[model samples]
Target: MPRFSSDGVDIAYFDEGAGDPVLLIHGFASTKEINWVNPSWTKTLLGAGYRVIGFDHRGHGASQKLYDPELYHTRLMAEDACNLLAHLGLPRADVIGYSMGARVGAQMALLFPQAVRSLVMGGLGIHLVDGVGLPQTVADALEAPSLDDVPDAMGRTFRAFADANKADLKALAACIRGSRQVLSREEVGRIFQPVLVAIGTRDSVSGAAAPLVELLPDGTQLDIPNREHNPAVGDKVFKEGALAFLKARP
Candidate 1:
């Protein structure tokens, strides 16, 4: 229920436990409680003797919502995160991000490298900006409300996407069309911190994790066989791997 004002917007966040801080950023359409709390991430990290801080991104969860397309840019999202860390009075903290949150985390590390101690990026890839492997028509259909009216698999998919009220889906679709700027391999190489990139082996949208593994300066990759994007994070295999990678860091 704790909240703070960042970039003139009221942001909702959860702060729990005590130790070196570990910030958790959830993906698009996922609230802090839905993504990290329900998944036991907060408990797991807390039990490991780390303080966990999670917040609802602007336009998502309990944070301020903006219908304007320009407000949803990755840069703005990153700034919101920076403000949160500053509000907490912490100069640096470990960052763990998933999916859309992963993109924001990467941008934060690039823009404020000193504020980040280590990075754990999951459910994402270097080419996240490249249309996310969805067909152009399917992507377009996500914005067209008439498309949302249809019934069937396509309708379900569109509804799922439109449900992420964090910055209008229409605006997000437009951003994708205009910039196509997800993350890039070059940017991955530029990350100088110790890094861990975890992926579900069966993840279709993010593609293979090998490409990301090869790009990091100091990186380790963990693949959860037979797991999909959402399930991979909770898998014992992933938890063990992630904890090991994070603890290995100084």
Candidate 2:
């Protein structure tokens, strides 16, 4: 329940355990509790002898909500993360980002490289370069009067998740629209840090991992078997691969 100001926006976060710090950024419409704590990611990393830092993005979780779509850019969110590191006086930390967070983490490594020692991008892949994330229809779904009004399959699913999360639909609607900035191949190619891209084999959202891996100077891919995007979060194989990657990262 701790908080910090990222350019005046209140960002809620939790810091626990002790060792190399690992910053955990959640996916769109997911809070830190929903994305990291409830999934036992905090437990997994803490058990692995690492300090865990998990934060709610600006429009999600216990953080302040802004209705302006312009306010939710990943660059600004990425700065929120770097500001958290600065708040704790840590020069750098290993980062693990899921879905939307992976995009933010990539921006972090690109714009604030000094704050990221290494990075693990989960539930996102080649789409990082090829796609802008989620879709405009997702924002439309959020703005829909009710879930039944949403027609897109993925949009309906996201609407349900957002409702279940008790999120501010207005704020999240803007987020889904504003945060879809895609990183170009050249932009991604510039992320010169040890990296791991883990995506579910069945995940239609993340595209493919190997193609994205090909762009990184030091990147590896992990295909989570028999899983899709959401299910892949707490997958045992995904955790094992991530831990292995984190341990071996310099």
Best by TM-score: 2
Error of 2 at 11 (Å): 0.7
lDDT of 2 by residue, 1-250 (tens): 7998989999899999999999999999998998888888899999999999999999898999999989999899999999999999999999999999999999999999999999999998988888889888989999999999999998899999999878999999999888988888998889999999999999999889999999998999998999989999989898899999998987
lDDT per residue as tens, model 1, 1-250: 8888887888999888899999888876567887788888888889899999999987677877665646767777778888888999998889998877887788888878988899888887654534343344544655667644645564356447556533356544543443224656677678898878888888866666667768878878888888887677677776677778779998
Segments in model 2 whose C-alpha atoms lie over 4 Å from true places? none
Per-residue lDDT value at 39 in model 1? 80
The 10-residue segment with the lowest total lDDT in model 1: 171-180
Clashing pairs in 2: none
Candidates in order have lDDT scores of: 0.74, 0.93
For model 1 the local lDDT of residue 106 reads 82
- For candidate 1, the per-residue lDDT at 37 reads 87
| Model 2, position 27: C-alpha lDDT score | 94
